[model samples]
Target: MNNNIKTILITGGAGFIGSNLCEHFLNKGFNVRVLDNFATGHRHNIAPFNNNHNFQLLEGDIRNLKNCHQAVEGVDYVLHQAALGSVPRSINDPITTNDVNVSGFLNMLVASRDAKVKRFVYAASSSTYGDSESLPKVEDVIGKPLSPYAITKYVNELYADIFSKTYGLETIGLRYFNVFGRKQDPTGAYAAVIPKFVIQLMKHESPVINGTGDYSRDFTYIDNVIQMNELAMTTSNQKALNTVYNTAVGDRTNLNELLNYLKEFLAEYDANIGNVEIIHGPNRAGDIPHSLASINKAKILLGYKPTHKIREGLREAVSWYWSNLK
Candidate 1:
């Protein structure tokens, strides 16, 4: 198989991050196949790629081992992005999140092992840091997960580790920190900040600010996330394999700063829209006060470098949401 182009199976490829992955790989000349049930992922996300000869879409759920088997069968690598993702959503129904994020993850790992794929790269979350107050989160040190969603992602790292040792499966996990950008669904209650803010502002509606707006995050962009996934999947370095790396720009932006930033970006679209207000609400359950990532390891090992910071990212995100949603 040519190293530059190989068949890649990306789970949840119709979802926000997954769809981005599909587009990225197809652009790079790789044969891309997607496994998604369209539960949370929308068909419109992948509509642009439907006619591409290099892209193949499979209508299946990761919960089904048969689907996992088929998806893993002719792939050189596996980018396992499928999961039930949101802390609040997990709080509302822990069992369903656990079933999909945990159980379904296992199904993908097992199937990938059986297929003898080159590498298994999956999405891990910064939520894994949980209550850890460390300014810049290091990969080795971690605190107990505060939410079921965090627990699921942390478990993915654990399973990836165990699988590497026990089953000799090569795995790498990318711990995403507040990733946001194009194709993010703002309609969902569990939608991430950037998209939700963009949509609400576009509709001349008030955006909710959970807590005192002091809560901060190392908001990552989608393009950076795609670079991380690709680097993890293609790395040949022994030290880079069988571990997790923090995928972020290593900069922190508080909710207040982010809100103002979004508003400023939106006002460029319509000056009158600048008056949109923010409603303060109580802090959410299982939310960490601050989040920042230490990306020293990923940079050294995988040659991973994040290209976009919050401002540059929000510009792209806000513009896409405006053009696409409105």
Candidate 2:
């Protein structure tokens, strides 16, 4: 154990975002430890890091207090990314969603508090905006939760605030938008729109749009998310601690446009992909008509300058999926 190098404990470290964090920190010479139960995350995602001396994996669940505590031991910072995501999944099984996203989050807070970890940065959600009609969602102006998953993530913010105020634990929550990129699984039932669409288009299959194809999102890229997590963990400004920031690109693209972008990118690799038709499905329940983020707060507070917007991020994501999934 090198006393000089900081140790970061990233829960859900085998997932798309978490594994990326592991790679980033390890490359920067930080000791990275992961705690995951392999529920939703894949082993192949973190397999590359297994041989790195600075990387450690603790196969456990955040729902377990003992596991949380063990994970926090000797850790300087904690990035809590372990949560049951997807609004539809939460609607279908609210109980399991609450158990992991809320109960499990509480356990992590308690563990980090007791461990006296320097900072606790978590993966919050843009879904917390709920029914708010705000064009660019500011952090404070949110409406009622639209789904079970939104409630759980909102509860996480409340618990984190309480932990910060009551126990003096430093915490930061990043309300991530539609984040997608390399290593994001496209086969899952709750797969994110971008990766799913990319994979579908690559196979010359028609991608389905949930709504009338007008609903838009602030589709954030994985590298931007990784940057936010790093900033949240390392910022020295006292005012930056114990608050939530919207992790997004401050831009919105509708489902129809999103599909077109996928087609344009994928067609470059396989020209026939451009001819693939699109299928429109019924509007998904618990989905907001439009979602866009005001990243000004994150920019002002954490110095977050998104390196990739929709087209730039999507182009790279499509390339990665074509290479890896093909």
Candidate 3:
């Protein structure tokens, strides 16, 4: 990878995945700039990087074209991670979700295109699979969206495709499947299962499992996602550009298995976490029963070999929460 490509713009840089990307690229000596409105992102997530001379923060919203344009200026690459994330949140407020995920995504695309960014790498979602029952989801196969959030993400892919074809902009979409790891927020109504479960167990509270606990997901680690972004940004492969790839480990784990692992890891810090009873709840409206990714496309196209599997990543994440949030 050429270190000469100095500047990188990460949208939603104050958020979990985006903050991680900011740190990774900043450590690599790239001039990293962040555009975030702090709507769902936290100030503390980016506080440590404020002192870094190479880090610049554009406290703005992607919903505004001026903010997107300001963030993309002089940036070689754009990692679009800003969006209203949660299926249920979108269910309650589809309009807001569509505005940010769909409209804001278009704004970023137009800004990056006009700026002549070297590459635009954006976060796509596994929910786009929707009602498709196929196990181990492939990039091409998709069903009708089950929720407004899914529709918005699918629209993002569509816009990216049209932008690439019509405007000659290089873009790559990463359909992230339940990404979890360090800096992931475990609070609020829409928090992801892993982090939310970790927080519950840490507090010795009964972690509620949506559905029968048999439903599974390909819970990807944040590090794997970060690697995918870097590869997508820097890859010289002509075929790899302007296409979507599964950014996840090619594996699946059910809620039952997930809780067991969370207990095993968290019990290291507090043995009582093992006694935390798992509670059952109704299945979430937009959630699929099972989600597993076929990483063959990522491996062949971008040479992506995930460093951490579920257990390893969970252990690391547990340790972080215990040390920092406990």
TM-score of each prediction: 0.97, 0.99, 0.98
Residues 87-107, candidate 2: write the lDDT tens digits. 999999999999999999999
Q: Please identify model 3 stretches exceeding 4 Å from their true place.
A: 1-5
**Candidate 1 versus the native: TM-score?**
0.97
Predicted candidate 3 versus true structure: per-residue lDDT over 90-189, tens digit per residue = 9999999999999899999999999999889999999999999997899999999999999999999999999999999999999999999999999998
| lDDT of every model, 2 decimals | 0.91, 0.93, 0.93
State the weakest 10-residue window (summed lDDT) of model 1.
1-10
Model 3 scores what on Cα lDDT? 0.93
**Candidate 2, poorest ten consecutive residues by summed lDDT:** 195-204
Which ranges in model 1 have alpha carbons more than 4 Å from their true place?
1-5
CA RMSD, predictions in order: 1.6, 0.8, 1.8
Any runs in candidate 2 off by more than 4 Å, and if so which? none
- Candidate topping TM-score: 2
